[model samples]
Target: MTIIDGKLTKHYARVWDYCHELLRSNPGSTVQVGVTVNPDQTTYFHKMYLCFKAIKEAIGRDASNQVYPIAWAVVDIENKANGKWFLELLTEDLNLLDGGGFTGLLEATKEVLPNVERRQCARHICANFRKTYTGMEFNNMFWAASFSTVESEFLRKMDDIKEVDPNAYENLLARHPHTWYRAFFRTDVACEAVENGIAECFNAIILDARKKPLLAMFEKLGCT
Candidate 1:
């Protein structure tokens, strides 16, 4: 089901039909949730329409000879993307009881999918970390700490950051490095991404479509 300008928009696509099957095959898949502002659409309840996207990976082929994990089962909805209301609907529809997800949507995930492995995007954290700390040395150290796969290596990298700037090290700690650092991520999911690149890529694919009128945007997103 798709909503546009607070109205239900019905569109038939095989993606919805195969959503269950795809998820079944890709058990424990990490879902990336993101909200993109739809500037061209608005309603009385909101100033800008929010396009909520939920994307996961599946075994598929982009070209005849290429077989790899591709992003599929993209859920695009036009509504207020904040709060747990939309997330509840999405999880109910997809039957996503437990999985991994980005930290931006952690609160809602806690309520809807409490067992989900919460991961914060290192890129987003770095953006905030840069506000108070800026320099090639600080940036390099921060990333090194995030990418460290071993506990000792992670601590060594963090000590490097601390030697450069104690405040910067404290800031990263406050943001909960456990959620963003690769060393703390669960091995059961077999995912190593410290960023929400999949969700961003899906958003980019619908960038132009999101600017269209309500119904038109739904059509494009459903078909895309």
Candidate 2:
């Protein structure tokens, strides 16, 4: 389920309670929760705090069980700086590693829940690539890498690009190889699900919403 307002302590607590109850009732049953926090969104810091709290609560008090096995995905529309902010906030709050927020969360969760697997959204990764690189070559390389599952094919294209501009290859693959491109390609189906419908639907909704004043539109919809 999507928890819209992570800043509301009551709501966060309720969700945590429900998650705990669900886990307790079904021992050994794996539970996966996907969370998308837009740093540009209001109360993002609070949401990060709430996510930390949920992770801590799920793992219990013992340091041995301190690792909470929960899968969380954070989606952001801002640049890398904002993404880094969220990642830093998550690591500081949850005492995670120095890598991406999802990676840190996965490590922490695994210590307690062995079955939990964390994943990053491919859409955001693609956006990051687009933001960092400024030409069709970069775009071509990214798409080729993203769509291709075989590492050899991905690297072959990277090599092809590198032959022309070595800097591009170095820049894209400078960071963690597994986290950057392989993560998304590894689970193509998940990427397909998000890309196929959800993103388009959200874009349409956003376009429709942008045409009018948000408050007036919400009022028309009886939101308030």
| TM-score of every prediction relative to native | 0.64, 0.38
Off by over 4 Å in 2: 1-116, 130-132, 180-224
Lowest lDDT 10-residue stretch of candidate 1: 43-52
Worst 10 residues of 2 by lDDT: 215-224
Q: Pick the candidate with the highest lDDT.
A: 1
RMSD of 2: 12.6
Q: What are the per-residue Cα lDDT tens digits for candidate 1 across 101-156?
A: 42333444666667778778888889888887887788888889999998999999
lDDT tens per residue, model 2, 1-224? 12432333454445445556546765643333335545566543222212424444222223452223222222334455444444445455455553322222233334432333343444565677668667887777776765555678778877876886777678667644454455243342232221223333434544543343322232222221
Model 1 regions more than 4 Å off: 1-83, 98-104
Q: What's the residue-level lDDT of 21 in candidate 2?
A: 58
Relative to the unseen true structure, what is the C-alpha lDDT of residue 122 in candidate 2, on a scale of 0 to 100? 46
